[model samples]
Target: MNKYLLTIFTLFIAMSGFAESPDSTEIAIKEIEQSLQYQTGTIKLKEGHGTLIVPKGFHFLDQEQSKYVLSDLWGNPEDNTIIGMLFPIHVGVLDDHSWGFTISYDPMGYVKDDDANTINYDDLLASNKKDILAENQERLNSGYGTIELIGWASTPYYDSNKKVLHWAKEIKFDGDSANTLNYNLRVLGREGIYLVNAVASMDELPEVNKNLDQLIASVQFDNGYKYEDYTDGDQIASWTVGGLVAGKILAKTGFFAAILKFWKIIAVGIAGGFSFLWKKIRGRNENDTIEAPTKPIQEENDEDSTKS
Candidate 1:
């Protein structure tokens, strides 16, 4: 009986400990979903060129009668005149104590084929990768601050005429572990909407790499929104990523464990009751009284008076 009781008590303690640990995947998804829901209205696409860059403080926007809304860092609605396609980039969560990081990207819209095809083949085919870095360095030296390189990858892109000329770069980031995850999709060229990508990190936990591919896959251009519609074939793109993050957030938040916490509460109550009963019993035994006091009398004097 004692062994059985001890086993149950040990199990109770173990379960209580498990309840304290939190999951990040679960937390991130919910957070992502909440952010998406509030994001309503239309996003006015901002355009940029290969050489002539878009001005700073530019952003996506949507006025009334739109399903999405975007603003500049200063909260001003982005201008539609220069807008092209929406690119949502960098979506993630960062926690300091756990040490984590995540980043992702999604692309959309179509740029002019001839314009996109104008790539510096000689520069790209050059044997020295350092040359590319050197050029980036020159730009930094001129006016741009120190540039931090994350990771980059190039994928093939084809136009309606089956002309393969465009490519996309996947960029990552590094910074304070506690910084809120940032997602930015700057429309460099119109082809496809770029999914929002971001990196998240926690100080103690391993970085939870954000999967941009999933977000990218979620995109679907509205009907007749493709390059073909504007140029030759089709250009419409459409996608949704809230669900992917939602799953991760659910896992990380320990929401599953929330149900388990109910059992923990019961265990705690039983343990507390046992402790109270044990204390009460111990106190009663420890405070037991030994004996009662009695009084003496003047019996001799009373007998003498009776005899007289």
Candidate 2:
């Protein structure tokens, strides 16, 4: 971690030519690394929902740490809805090649799986592409780069017995040389769905896809909240298997709002995140917005896309 900080700081100094206080840089880096507090073993989910048995070669950061990584390290706006994050042991959260699964649970209630087997993922993919095209004008109007839905890296698959749905999408942001990967997992519970989203570049698709099953097996709802525990009059989710597969996107604000989230990836790697780090290391006013350091844009994100 110290090495990573040093490397980034060295690059920061070289790029900006600011021989700023090394003491401050070292301290901030130490604080940020310590803030991660990555752990393994059994992790009890909040609200008695379930447990995450973090596998070997991986680490889990609880809500506070996850929020810090997302908002601070990743240069994203603060989002408290996230439950945690899962990362492999090999990479620091700040690594340019870093990728992780963000975990957030939505108590949207029991989602019936009657349509699980019937969903035509190819049709859904076509619809998603059209939606992206339809929304590109608004994105251009908003002075943001248009997003291209390149189709599924992994087609949607739902396991009715386990009440789980998962899929992956390959997306391209305007002007970017590389594409982004959005891998989603929905584990239905008696009262809600657990949303696990993998954020990475398409370069990591093989790795993310390889571990999908293991990651899926790690999260399990506690006894009463298990899928089979649904009762006669319990709350029900409006989404079905298809909706879960279409998780982060909507016909409405989905892709537009997701811009706030995905653009951070631009800053973190493609655009050089040194400015965000410099400000954090040097300290800043509380009211200042944490943006992706890319283009200046609106802050609305896919809160509904993730939590609702």
| lDDT leader | 2
Per-candidate TM-scores read 0.27, 0.75
Residue 51, model 2: Cα distance from true site in angstroms: 1.5
Question: Mind giving the per-residue lDDT tens digits that candidate 1 earns over 12-93?
Answer: 4655443322333244224432443212133323322121112222222222111111111101122222222222223211
Per-residue CA lDDT of model 2 for 1-308, tens digit only, reads 11223344455546544433545444545555665678899999874388999976789998977766665465344556678889989976655577888887788888888887788888888877886787677655644557788988888888877777888788787766778787778888999888888867888889997888789899999999999998999998887777766544532233211222332222333234365554543243344454423322322222254310
For candidate 2, the per-residue lDDT at 87 reads 91
Query: lDDT of all the models against the reference?
Result: 0.25, 0.65
Spell out the clash pairs found in candidate 2.
none
Query: Residue-pair clashes per candidate, as listed?
Result: 90, 0
